[model samples]
Target chain A: MKYDCDACGPELGAYLLGESSDETRREVDAHLAACTACRDELERERALRTALGDLPTATCPGAVTARILAVVDAEYAATRRRNRRLRGVGLAGGLLAATLAAVLFLRPGAALRGASAEHYTPEQVATARHELIQTLTLTARVLDQAGRSTLVDVFNDQLPSAVEGSLRPLDDPTRGG
Target chain B: MTNETFHELLATHRDRVFTQALFSLRERRDAEDVTQEAFLRLWRQGDHLPADRVAPWLAHVTRNLCIDQTRRRSAARRHLGVADADAVDGLVAAAGGPDDPFAGLDLDDRQRRLLDALQTLPAETRTVMLMHYGDGTKLADIADAMGKSLAAVKVQVHRARQRLRLVLGTADGVSEQRGSA
Candidate 1:
C-alpha cells in the first residue's frame, strides 16, 4: 500500500500545534510504528515545531498605535484639503473664463475698435490737413516736457524761420480747428 | 454598550491585540499602531456587533492589519536596499538577547539561517506560522482569524512546519527527517 499519509498530514499539522485529537494521535502512531521514515519525519517535525514555538514573540514598537493613528489622521486631513482646494480652483477658473468671455462678447466695439478715433483714410486725412492750413491752421502740440523739447529741436533743425513762426500760433491752449 | 463598558473592553483586549501585532509584524511600533487602529475600527463598528463578539472581532481585524503590514514589509524588501526589512531577518540580526531560544546553541548559525529562510516565506504562510508558534494560537483559532477553512489551515500549517523542519534540521537534536517512504 502506498502509505496513507492523508490522515497523517493533518495529524502532523495538529501534532505540531498540540491540537491533535486522540484518534489522530493513535493513527499517526500506528503509521510511525510500521514506517521508520514517517517516524523520523514525525520526530523532526515535532522538534522543529518546539524550537519555533520556544522563540520569544517580538514586541512591536511602543508608540506604534499613536504613530499609525497620527498618519491616518494626517492623510485624511490632506485628502480633505486637496478636495476643497480642487473645488475652489475649479470654481475660480470657471468664473475667470466666463468673465473674460463676457467681456469680449458684450463689448465687441471695444475689441474691434480701430487704432484711434482720429485715424482717417489717406485722402481724407490730407484734405483735412490742407483745409486746416488754408483756413483755421490747426496744429498738433506736444504737452509733455520731453515731447516739447523734441518738437522744439525738430522744428529748429528741420524747418525754416518763417515756417517755425507760422507754427507758433498753434501753441495757444485755446487754439483748435 | 455604554461608553464606560466600551472603554473597558478596549482596555481589556489592548494587550492581546498589541502582543499579537508585535509578534506578527515583529516590530513594536507597528504592533502598537495596529492595535490602536484595530481598536479604533472596533469602536467605529461598535454598533454592528454585540459585546461578546468584541475579542474575536478585534482579533480578526488585527490579524488582517498585521497581514497587510507583513505584505507591505515583504514588498518593500523586494525593492532597493531593504534586505533585512523582513521581520524574521530583523529578529535574527538584531534580536541578540539571551531570551532568544535560538541565541545559544551548537548550531547557532544553522538556527539563524533557518530563521532567515522562514523570513522569506510568503506573508500568509509566515503569519500562519507565527500565530501557530509565537502566539500559541490553536489551528482552529488561526483558521478563523485567517479566514481559511479548517482543513486548508491544517494543510497550510503542515507545509509551514515541514519547511521549518527542513530549515532547522532536527532542531534541538532529534535527527534530520528520513524521506517519506
Candidate 2:
C-alpha cells in the first residue's frame, strides 16, 4: 500500500477538509506516515483552512436589503391590483347571469308562465327570445373577458335547457295566442 | 410567500449570499448588486422551491450571478485594453475605504496573503472554497447546489489549495521535487 506523492497530494485537501472517505483516509494516513513532504503539505493545507475560517464575515448593507424588499413589495402590489380587477369583472358577470335567470323565470307573467297562459302574441315571444339570446351572448363575453371563460361553458350547458321550454312558442306562432 | 416570511428569508441568508458574492467578485458594489438580484429571484420563485431547498437555491443563483458579473468585468477590461491584474490588488488598494467590507478588519500577514491568493483562483474554485470553509457547507451539499459532481468539487478544492500554496511561496520545495520526478 505505497501511495506516491502524486496520488496522495490531491487527497491532502480532502483529508484536511474531513471530506475523504474511510479507505481514502487510511491510504492518505499511511502515505503521510512514510512521507514527510506530504505531511508538511497537509499542515499547510490545515493552516490555509484556519486562515480562511478566520476571515471576517461580510454583511449585506441595509440599502441593498431595502432595495430588494421594495422591489418585491411593488411586485406584490401589482399582482393584487390585477387580481382585484379580475374579481370585479367576475362579479359583474355573475350579476348579469343572475338577472338574466330572474327575468326569464321569476317576473309576473314572465316567459315561463306566458308559454302556458295563451296571453302573449307572436311578436312579444319573438322579442323575448331575441333579448334572451342577446343577454346570454353579452354574459358570455363578460365572463370570457374576466379570464373565467370556463364558467361560460357551464352557462352554455345549463341555461339552454332551463330556457328552451319557455322559448318553445317561437316554433309555433299560434301557441303564444 | 408572505411579506413577513420573505423578510425572514432575507434576514437569514443575506450575509452568506453577500459574503459569497464578495469572495467571488472581490468588489463590494458588485457583490451587493448580485446579492440583491439573487434575493429578488428567490422572491419570484420561492413558491416553487421547497423550504429545505431555499438556501441551496439561493447559493446556486448567487454563484451564477457572481460568475456572470466577473465575466462581464473581464470582457469590459479586454474591450478597454486594460491589463487585468489580480483582483485582490483592487481590494488591497481600497482596504481602508468606506465601501470596502474588509476595511476595518485585522488581517495578519499569512491571512492577508491567503486572501489575496484566493482572488486569483477561478470564480468556481473560489466559490467552492468559500462554501466549504467560510460558510461550513458540506462538500456533498456544495456539489448538489452547484450541480457538479462530488469528484469535481473535490478536485476544485484541491486545485484551490495548490494554487494558494504556490502563490504564497510555500510550495517551492515539494513542487520542485515533484516537477523533477
DockQ of each: 0.15, 0.28
**Per-model lDDT:** 0.58, 0.73
The alpha-carbon deviation from the true structure for residue B113 of candidate 2, after best TM-score superposition, in angstroms, is 1.5
- Residues B94-176 of candidate 1 have per-residue lDDT tens digits of 76732433222344454455556576666578667756665566777767756778889888877776666566554423244
Q: Can you give the TM-score per candidate against the true fold?
A: 0.48, 0.69
TM-score of 2: 0.69
| Best-performing candidate as measured by TM-score | 2
Give residue A175's error in model 1 in angstroms.
82
Candidate 2 wrong stretches, greater than 4 Å:
A1-38, A86-120, A123-127, A130-177, B78-101, B171-181
For each candidate, C-alpha RMSD in Å? Answer: 19.8, 8.9
Look at candidate 1 and tell me the lDDT of residue A87. 56
Which docking class does model 1 fall in? incorrect
